[model samples]
Target: MAKLFGNLELVLIVGLVAALAIIGAFASSVVVDANSILRWLHLFFGVLWIGLLYYFNFVQVPTMPAIPAEQKGAVTGFIAPKALFYFRWAALLTVVTGLGIAQVNGYLHTAMSFTGEGAVNLIGTGMWIALVMAFNVWFIIWPNQKKALGIVETTPEQKAAAGPRAMIASRLNTLLSLPMLYCMVSANLG
Candidate 1:
């Protein structure tokens, strides 16, 4: 049991197989289609991105100063870099899958251009918000994070400038995630 739970890849594989089996069994109620697959991928990676974002904002960042100076290496050296890798990739994939979903549903242009009525307009709002957040993740947050976490060598002054920039960008994403999620959910339904 411990061994099974210890490996994330193994756990995810087993979970995927199990879910496929169950969904297969209940195929009458659930239709597996391209749009659905895209939605699943979008949801999965969105969770990963947002989960890591929260972890950074709520857990790692706040606790960094509290960690013993000598012990800071454990986080800055090992944990944060790896977490950031997943965080950024997840953000990328989420955007990709979301765009795929929109394209498949034949609303990509209308939703993004905001030239349509009803749900397209609503979803456009969410899409734009997500695009902004993704931009922050890749462009602003990531570069600043590299300096702040010492992934990139910098002078003390530059590094000092980076930390708060990264944090504020991260917090901005956190604030946007709430309404972004709401817009995504409510767009089609409402």
Candidate 2:
């Protein structure tokens, strides 16, 4: 059991297989809802992305100063880079799945127009905000982080400059996440 759990890929595969089996067993006929599936994916990836974002901002950043200088390598050298890979990909997946859900549900245009009443307007605003956040994750944060994390060849001064830039961008995304979530939930549900 310990070994099974230790292998992440194996664990995920088993979990997914079990979930599918359960679903198959309960239903008379299998029918998939595209929008619902995409929504689920969007929610899953969004949580991953935001959770990592929060981890970086709330936990890692604050605690870094407390970590002994030599011990910091455990994080900067290993953990952060791994986490950021997932973080950025999760951000991309979240946006793709979210937009796919919107498009499938016939709200893509209405929600993206940035001018509408009720759900359309609310969702549109959220969509736009999320898009911007995702943009930051890809275009701004990731590039800067490559330098900041020493994943790229850069001068010490340039790396120093990049770290703060990436941090600021990440913080901005964190700030935006709250209202974006509210709009996403409130738009259709509220």
- Global lDDT of each candidate: 0.92, 0.89
Q: Please, what are the lDDT tens digits per residue for candidate 1 over residues 62-166?
A: 999899999999998899999999999999999999989988888899899999888788889999999999999999999999998899989999999998998
RMSD (CA, Å), candidate 2 to true, equals: 1.9
As for candidate 2, its clashing pairs are none
lDDT score, candidate 2: 0.89
Stretches of candidate 1 above 4 Å error? none
Q: Provide TM-scores for the models.
A: 0.95, 0.93
What TM-score does structure 2 among the candidates reach?
A: 0.93
Tell me which residue pairs clash in candidate 1: none
Which is the leading candidate under TM-score?
A: 1
